[model samples]
Target: HEAKINGLSITEVDFSTLSDDEAMLKVMMIDEPEKLSAAIAQLPASLYEQYNILQSAPFFLEFLHTDSHKGIGVKAIAQQFGINADEVICMGDAGNDKQMLEYAGLGVAMANASDDIKAIANHITASHNDDGVALVIEEFVLNK
Candidate 1:
């Protein structure tokens, strides 16, 4: 409904029901992503439940629960595994990864990542295809 009202298309959803007990999930992978982005940016502040908008992909817009962000999930997992926030190494190259990168002990942005991500990341690595992950592991793990 939010997508519809915002003139965006909800291409795929894994929701079985809209009950509050179940996590309400929605994604808008529009054919016209530029339009969706523009509309979302200009969305009027409403009294509806606040949502965590993630531009996970250039053409994908995922709307998750207000408190459901990657950083929170990463922190929870790190805690469960008895890891400190600074002991976690997170590498990402997209908007959805912003929080995770910021929260990680070693935040690495891909060479292809956006300026926003690079600005917040602790370090920058090669592009994915160039084996950026391998480079980090080699330098931080094998070399160390």
Candidate 2:
């Protein structure tokens, strides 16, 4: 694979026998995120037509259909459950979670999050290892 040759890790590729119209690839930057970006620029966009590239973390990336994204997924789930976005509290510390965090009514970034992620979050909790999620649960859910 071109990406693998360019220093990325090709984790998996799924192409449905049902129809080649849908396909997806999961890959990792593997400490070479900067290089991966450069390679992407050189590669032809038509290599995978009508696809979406989501970098969930600095090191993790997924290629999916253009119509799909974490933010869209979150919105759909919230709507299905009859919960308004304003009523939800989303917490994250990764690039992939950025859109979802921003779409939520209350976005909480962890203390260990990247500066870019922290900038847009509504609140910042403790680090993941510090039980930051529990802090959210207690403060917003338990109110104790």
Candidate 3:
């Protein structure tokens, strides 16, 4: 109903038989954060070994293969293009971004990011709405 009111597009699918190879499970736009957290906590510990279960937001959970992450992708691209890891700069503001932020030579968290994100970041910049990306590029990349 909320989606309808907001003119959003969504498709409901039966996931009971979905294979991990076929899909990366995403439970999105959850209305109840506490219940979702409780349910996640109840999941088997062994399941975590096979998947990277990321709570991207208070209401969003994403499950992907353990071997797949933003960090891995960034590393792969850097290696392929002959760009050193020490030359890479990454920024983010969500739990899903944890890996990439950690992998970067300079990890920048948005000022509006969660506490845990800030804890892992090398620096904290302005919020997304305040041109945070531009600021990082100007100061760190352009160095002027």
Among the numbered candidates, top TM-score falls to 3
The true-versus-predicted C-alpha distance at residue 83 of model 1, in Å, is 0.9
Best first by lDDT, ranked: 3, 1, 2
- Error (Å) of candidate 2 at residue 10 is 7.6
- Give the per-residue lDDT of model 2 (tens digit) for 1-144: 456657965545443443755443443344467866676677677745756665666656566666565778889999999999998899998777778898999999999988878999999999999999999889988996
For residues 36-56, what per-residue lDDT tens digits would candidate 1 score against the true structure?
778677766661267777677
The local lDDT score (0 to 100) that residue 142 gets in candidate 2 is: 92
Model 2 regions lying over 4 Å from their true place: 1-22, 25-31, 37-51
Clashes of each: 0, 1, 0
Whole-model lDDT, model 3 = 0.84
Residue 128 local lDDT, model 2: 99
Instruction: In candidate 3, list every pair of residues with a backbone clash.
Output: none
RMSD for each of the candidates: 6.4, 6.3, 3.5
Winner on lDDT between 2 and 3 is: 3
Candidate 3 residue-wise lDDT at 59: 72
